[model samples]
Target: MSATEIPEPQVWLDERGRPCPLPVIAMAKAAKSAHGSPVIAVLADDPGARYDIPAWCRMIGATYLGEISVPDDKGGSAYVVQISESAQTDASKSIG
Candidate 1:
């Protein structure tokens, strides 16, 4: 879906200033505890997140909604992900 069409994120992960892989790792943990949030927005300043976030989403079957640029004070933008219903079902099945 378009960035504008995507819903506001229920889970917000702030990983600004952290290094590569850390942001993605935090995002993964946050996503796991999201409890079916439609969207999870991760604020990361790490350049690797520009690629890792989307890659992680693909690996987990989540939809990479888009990235939203934060103000200069925030350091960088946020990568928004939409956790698909199918993905949630799959996760639940795996846990059960």
Candidate 2:
């Protein structure tokens, strides 16, 4: 989704500077407390995140809505995921 189209009070994660897998881990962690199919925005400069987030969604059954633009100061692109409302009642409780 576009910047204006992003969900209100969305979970915005700053996973920049983290190593491989950390960004995905952080995204999954935030999703664990989520309700509805809220969109999550992860600001990550790690190149792996571009590939990892979508892979995580495929494995976790969430929707990978692709990346969106952020302000120059954000220092990273925002990758969004739509937590499937039916995926879990307590969000993603497992790491697998």
Candidate 3:
């Protein structure tokens, strides 16, 4: 998929107002439980997440689809990640 293409997230994680690490931690957990979903979207306000989530994806071999702005009422933006079937397998193996 193109860098600008963001799939509809099969799993949505709302981590707005949560501190650093928490957003990424919740994202990892959500991703682990996604059951082969193509995309997982994490809603977070933490400035750190703008970097941390992508970094986590890199470390885990998942595709960081990039972030999209959320409505002000919902918070700042949502971080989108694409997990390939192979990446899911890799992640599961690593987690287990």
Best by lDDT: 3
lDDT of 2: 0.76
Can you rank all candidates by lDDT, best first? 3, 1, 2
Clashes of 1: 0
Worst window of 10 by summed lDDT in candidate 1:
87-96
Instruction: For candidate 3, report its TM-score.
Output: 0.81
Superposed by TM-score, candidate 2 places the C-alpha of residue 25 at a distance from the truth, in angstroms, of 0.6
TM-score of each: 0.80, 0.79, 0.81
The residue-by-residue lDDT of candidate 3 on 1-96, one tens digit each, is 453577767777888989889988887666667776568888988889999988988888888987766635765688899887666676677768
Name model 3 segments beyond 4 Å from true. Answer: 1-4, 93-96
**Candidate 1 accuracy as lDDT:** 0.77
Task: Give residue 10's lDDT in candidate 3 (0 to 100).
Answer: 76
lDDT tens string, model 1, 4-94? Answer: 7767787778899899888887776666556754688889888889999888788778889898766358678789988876666654554
lDDT of each: 0.77, 0.76, 0.79
What is the C-alpha RMSD, rounded to one decimal, of candidate 2? 2.8
Clashing pairs in 1: none
Report how far off residue 72 is in candidate 1 (Å): 7.0
Q: Evaluate residue 58 in candidate 1 and report its C-alpha lDDT on the 0 to 100 scale.
A: 82
Q: lDDT: which is higher, 2 or 3?
A: 3
**In model 1, what lDDT does residue 40 have?**
83
